[model samples]
Target: MNNRLRTTLALLSLAALAGCRGDREDAPPREFFPDLDTQLKWTPQGRSEMFEDGRTMRQPPAGAVPFGRRAGVSDAAWASPWASERDRFLRDDPAYFDGTSGRDAAGNPVFIEKLPASVSVDKALLLRGQERFNIYCSVCHGYLGDGKGTVGVQYSPVAADLNSPAFLVADAPQTKDGYIFNIIRHGKPKPDGSGGFTMPPYGHAMSEADSWAIVAYVRALQAARSAATPTTGGSR
Candidate 1:
């Protein structure tokens, strides 16, 4: 209670306060952080965080997602915070395939896209189709639509016999055109009798016009195969 005692106590209190402040300076205070008004400003870890019940703060599990959300897949939730990473390695990115506008930069299905309607039996287009098929499709469907390609048998589910009437060389070329387009555009979701999945949709690699070109060529090839059935196969 005397002057010296009082002075000593005040100095000790000040020293303790300074020590606490120094410790705080080294590491920002975390104990009191939760009580702050998080609604006003969010720190780096708070931007995409969600509050389960307005109190329980939750973050998407690392490599996890919410309901109706694709965590880290090609077809995952695009608007999620971590989408770019998902697409980097997908065998087929849906964004790259779907939501396209055959004309516009982004596919929106806005205008009457004419790619399917525009294709014809142009020799050049048909030739292009032939070359492309030889490279992409022939490995499985065989050069003559027979399910005899080496790759076809390698698959767990063998490829379909394209020469079959249900699929190939239909009596009417026009009817076959649309069917062929569907096969190329969406691919056979289920391979016929065979188990191997059909080729993924080529609607990404080639334009719709090119798809029809390929169809036309296949139809022509089918006709040729039928006409030249000498019990001999030399490839049309």
Candidate 2:
């Protein structure tokens, strides 16, 4: 072909390529994938004409439970931390999650006397418990569990002395591992049944494993106190 014809054809091709470049225009552009631009999904806090409530978000079904990570993920080496977290969310074990093994004849929850088998009672767990206790419990229970913390002194009904015999003796109801674990997570309810609590629950802020760790630490403190106290000799 002639050089002038070739130059004209090249110019036309360049112009066509420039037109394909996306740019602001007064007219609406054609969309090859309309779904990508306008998805068939409801936006958060948006109104929906299809539903009777006209709200985009719907309430979960009655008795519905939340699902967490799959059990298979627990087998992975890197997912060990998440494995424990998954168990916490699932809460299948009553003793570990609720701190109660069963109910007594009167229907009162029977708390377990020892920490669950899943929990590892070690120096690391105690250290973690100490750190968490200092941050949360020490404010009321005192660093030594003596109910003499700065905030405890000012509290209306002063915090309980955790080192007291009621909480130290092995057979004491309050000394049960599950009892302490439950108290740490669910707090103590007022006797009046006025929907009030003597102490506020910490389950929202703390994890189940951490609650168990605190129970272990509280036991350690009670044991230390018992050992230091000079026993009275009966005969000699």
Best by TM-score: 2
- Can you tell me which runs of candidate 2 are displaced by over 4 Å? 1-86, 229-236
Q: After aligning candidate 2 to the native by TM-score, how far in Å is the CA of 223 from where it should be?
A: 1.0
lDDT of 2 by residue, 1-236 (tens): 69999999999988986897777778777675587777678898999998999999999796433355454353656666766666767877888888889888999989999999889899999999889888999999999999888998787688888988787556777978998988889888988998787877898889888999989988888888778667798777
Where is the poorest 10-residue window by lDDT in model 1?
Answer: 109-118
Report, for every candidate in turn, its global Cα lDDT versus the true structure: 0.59, 0.84
Q: Return the clash pairs for model 1, or none.
A: 99-107, 100-107, 101-107, 157-195, 157-196
Clashes of 2: 0
Candidate 2: C-alpha lDDT: 0.84
RMSD of each: 16.1, 15.9
Candidate 1 lDDT for residue 159: 70
The superposed Cα distance between candidate 2 and the true structure at residue 144, in angstroms, equals 0.3
